[model samples]
Target: PLLKIANDMVVDLPTPSNISAWWNFGSLLGLCLVAQILTGLFLAMHYTSDISTAFSSVLIFLHETGSNNPIGLNSNTDKISFHSYFSYKHLVGFAVLLTALTALALFSPNLLGDPDNFTPANPLVTPAHIKP
Candidate 1:
């Protein structure tokens, strides 16, 4: 079945006899992009961006195949769709991400944010909110 599909898609596809070098350019770029994506997937599956371990993870190939971090390969593949831009799976995955972002913003706005951003414009004069 797979061979038949491949044959129909590639082997038996229509092509002009006078196809120029530009025609091959597109195919070459497609193959290069596919190779790059596969390599990126392999890398994402192996390493993690944990705050504490990120520095050390550089030295050792930290295997994250077992971990369920959202930045992992599974989550990346979940959003891919060749047929349509807004597929059901893609929308659901986006909704999940949006809900998590909203929850974090409502409950703990600065939980994962930089502490410096919450500071007063000028530390010498106490913040206006603290005066009242």
Candidate 2:
């Protein structure tokens, strides 16, 4: 039964021609997916799924200084700021991730399927529904 399904897959059929090196985007995409999954897992370890703690946990993970306290006469005045760190890193990471995803989408339009799959979200409503 599985073999029949595999045999019937017209989309999975490969051409007799050799694929160009440019076609390696699929492999690169797989690598990116792996990286995202691993990073996501690491993030999940520190993340709080509950609405009350979710934002705070993300802030702490992204912003908390990983140890670099100033030691001097005015040491009390110096405090580690997670806001700066988190904002910068988050922005950079998001930009890179979006760029990579966009490039993949461009390279392989069939990757995500038809236009019906592309749906816009109502951010305000999504959070309300996700809240526990």
Candidate 3:
């Protein structure tokens, strides 16, 4: 019954005569949100929630980064583009998301970290720059 109701809602849904990049981008964002939530759930299983350990845990995770990208699936109907074109279209969306993240990390890393983290470090020497 619930499945029938769900299908009925989307049954014969009309596609707009003219679609915009922004609408495609909006769907991309929705997909990204679902990916983020699922990945967060998995990470949360091991992540330290306590304030005391959260900072250290983040640093550990950062240091351990290599294969951190969450799985993503992109699908488009014949209306959007051909397979290769659809791939590049989604690539543009991914680029936009990556650029936003890079900007945040560069401009406001402190929003997620303490003043000590914002400080530059010389990895060659002792870790005196780190706050106690």
Task: Give the range of the ten consecutive residues with the poorest summed lDDT in model 2.
Answer: 2-11
Model 3 lDDT tens row, 25-109: 3676534644655566567766645654888888888667633334322332324336798899999999999999999999987
Estimate the overall C-alpha local distance difference test score of candidate 3.
0.61
Per-residue lDDT of model 2, residues 57-110, tens digit only? 777865664344435333645665588889999999999999999998888867
Compute the lDDT of residue 126 as modeled in candidate 1: 73
Worst 10 residues of 3 by lDDT: 71-80
* Model 3: lDDT of residue 86: 82
Instruction: Order the candidates by lDDT, highest first.
Output: 1, 3, 2
TM-score of each: 0.25, 0.26, 0.24
Clashing pairs in 1: none
In model 1, which regions exceed 4 Å deviation? 1-86, 117-132
CA error at residue 59 for candidate 2, angstroms: 22
lDDT of 1: 0.61
List candidate 3 segments past 4 Å from native: 1-81, 114-132
Per-residue accuracy of model 1 over 1-132 as CA lDDT, tens digit each: 533333334434456777533453358753554455566656766665454477767545555344545566566556655557558779899999999999999999879989898866875787667756
